[model samples]
Target: MLKERVINETVPIQKIYDEEIMKAHFSSETLPSVPLVYKIQPGSNQARKNLTPTLPSSSSFDIPDAYQSTNSDETFLIYDKLVSCKKRVLIFASPK
Candidate 1:
């Protein structure tokens, strides 16, 4: 059934220089002065793996406390709704 919605998609590919200039901090010397090339690809899984290291620091591991509601019944209700939707959500990356 899901096969009917399997449409093709195009994604851009980029190769950043100074990828390893420094892993801890960014300095003026390490920053790029101008925009770099933006290559397009038919599709590739490598981009998904390569992107983990490039995300901003704020999104790496921070979690909000509000999402952890104390009421068990409310949590179960939310879980039931999510299951009933029957949607396959492929979250490639999430904010930390």
Candidate 2:
């Protein structure tokens, strides 16, 4: 499994779900309209790292995973926000 971290300034959830941001990953044909979103509580679970590669002698390793407003209607249509850190994750909405 891959691991990512989210930190720094917290952004409002609404802005994170913008269409322009999601368009590349989800075309209208692929994304569900008004997908469900569950708010995850900020806690230690987020702190859990499955694996962190040991660095030789790095001073700073503060970068966190991409923080995203996730879709949670038992669907794959995921909308996340990443500015400059352009790595993207695509989730296709599940069929009901």
Candidate 3:
């Protein structure tokens, strides 16, 4: 298993998704499109930040795990499940 850490500055969700979609639109294997909606929230001014590992040259293997986001601004650690086989995932969405 491998690990990656990322911290993205705060930004609107739509902006982030748009940027990603535009970049992936030209890709050969891209996921289907999804509807877009924007709802301002308390932290709408904050940017989205995530940490993912840098894929190596060898594409034969998968990341082999999942992740969880933190509610507060803190460093979140991720571990491989190959050893424990536990699915520990978390997602921190903005308040509605």
Candidate 2 lDDT, tens digit per residue, 15-61? 44343336547777766754433343233135343233355353333
Clashing pairs in 1: 59-96, 62-96
Residue 53's lDDT within candidate 3 is 53
User: How accurate locally, in lDDT, is each candidate?
Assistant: 0.31, 0.38, 0.39
Which parts of model 2 are misplaced by more than 4 Å? 1-6, 19-25, 33-35, 39-96
Least accurate 10 contiguous residues by lDDT in model 3: 1-10
Lowest lDDT 10-mer window, candidate 2?
1-10
Any idea what lDDT model 1 has?
Answer: 0.31
Q: Write model 1 residue lDDT over 27-82, tens digit each, in one string.
A: 68656643333322222335444433444353233233333233232331132112
> Sorted on TM-score, highest at the top, how do the candidates line up?
2, 3, 1
Q: TM-score of the candidate numbered 1? A: 0.17
lDDT of 1 at 89: 24
Winning model by TM-score: 2
Off by over 4 Å in 1: 1-23, 33-96
TM-scores for all candidates: the values are 0.17, 0.25, 0.24
